[model samples]
Target chain A: EDKVVQSPLSLVVHEGDTVTLNCSYEVTNFRSLLWYKQEKKAPTFLFMLTSSGIEKKSGRLSSILDKKELFSILNITATQTGDSAIYLCAVALGGSEKLVFGKGTKLTVNP
Target chain B: SAVISQKPSRDICQRGTSLTIQCQVDSQVTMMFWYRQQPGQSLTLIATANQGSEATYESGFVIDKFPISRPNLTFSTLTVSNMSPEDSSIYLCSVRQGALTDTQYFGPGTRLTVL
Candidate 1:
């Protein structure tokens, strides 16, 4: 069965601290891996990684994929309270539009 | 990326009642999906709404419980029938623009609280 697993289900960190969230998946014919940040309502798209070893970055947030290991990591540098949200990782399978999502990492950044 | 909107942002419903959530996308999308997210849980795909065809539900989900409608390319609805406290969840609508490689854009989601 195709599944996505995210580690460190919950984390609390002080402002200015950096954090790393992990996601691993096992799927048939993997096509792409995506990261999303969910605040209160919908999850906003963060990054999409299709190739291994290439990092996708947006400001303080960066993510990289590893096809050989079937895992990915998202790193946030100098986090702030505004960065507190649930980080979700999803994988899309080839020939299918469905996205298998991980349980998500709830990061709470305190000032 | 597509812009999606959902109606009834939050609702308090009594048990035994039903709630229908609406999803609308700015552009015509190729695929639409309904998902359920319980408190502090991951998103689970409920069904795939196909335009001009019946919705395809996932394992452990049935059409009679979560009926879905996709009348067009950019509009769809999901109805939670015979609700219970266990059904209290965030119902999200997601859309894929062109192909399987396209990222799915999600709506704001309808927060349903069953009491």
Candidate 2:
């Protein structure tokens, strides 16, 4: 069975703090790893990492994957209160387009 | 990116009742996905709905309990039958477009509360 595990189910941090979220997975075939920020009912796309060692960035947020170790990390720099939300990690199955998701990391940013 | 919409953003239904949630995409899509997120839980795939074939359900999900309809490329519906309090959850609709690695976009979701 394919599974995705995320660390620090919940985190509390003050504004301007930097935090790192982790995701490790085990699947039959590796395809792609995706990160999403879900503030409410819908999850917005953040990054899709398909290669190892390369980093994908968007403003204050950045992510990188290590395929050999089968894990990924999402880093937020100078985090703001607005960045407080559930960060989800998902892996796309090799043969199928199906996505297996992690329990998610709930980051709480306080001003 | 696709603009997706879901009907009846939230509903309170009586036990044993049924409710059908609608999902509409701005553009035609090849595959649509239905998911359920239980309270405090991550999203779980309920099924994959295709335009010209029967919907494929994931493990722990069956067609009879959660029937799906894909009448066209731009629309689909998921019906929750014989609801119970345990069935209360947020049902989300999603679509994948563009290249093979394209991320799936989700609808606002329907929040169901069974009493």
Q: What is the interface RMSD of each candidate, in Å?
A: 0.8, 0.9
Which lDDT tens digits does candidate 1 get at residues B1-115? 8889999899999999999999999999899999999987899999999999999999999998999999999899999999999999999999887763558889999999999
TM-score of 2: 0.98
User: Per-residue lDDT of A1-111 in model 1, one digit per residue for the tens?
Assistant: 999999899999999999999999999989999999998979999999999999999999999999999999999999999999999999988987678999999999999
- Find the candidate with the highest TM-score and give its number: 2
* Docking quality (DockQ) for each candidate: 0.81, 0.78
> Chain B vs. true chain B: TM-score for each candidate?
0.97, 0.96
Instruction: Give one digit per residue, the lDDT tens place, for model 2 in B5-72.
Output: 99989999999999999999999887799999999999999999978778999999999999999999
CAPRI class assigned to model 2? medium
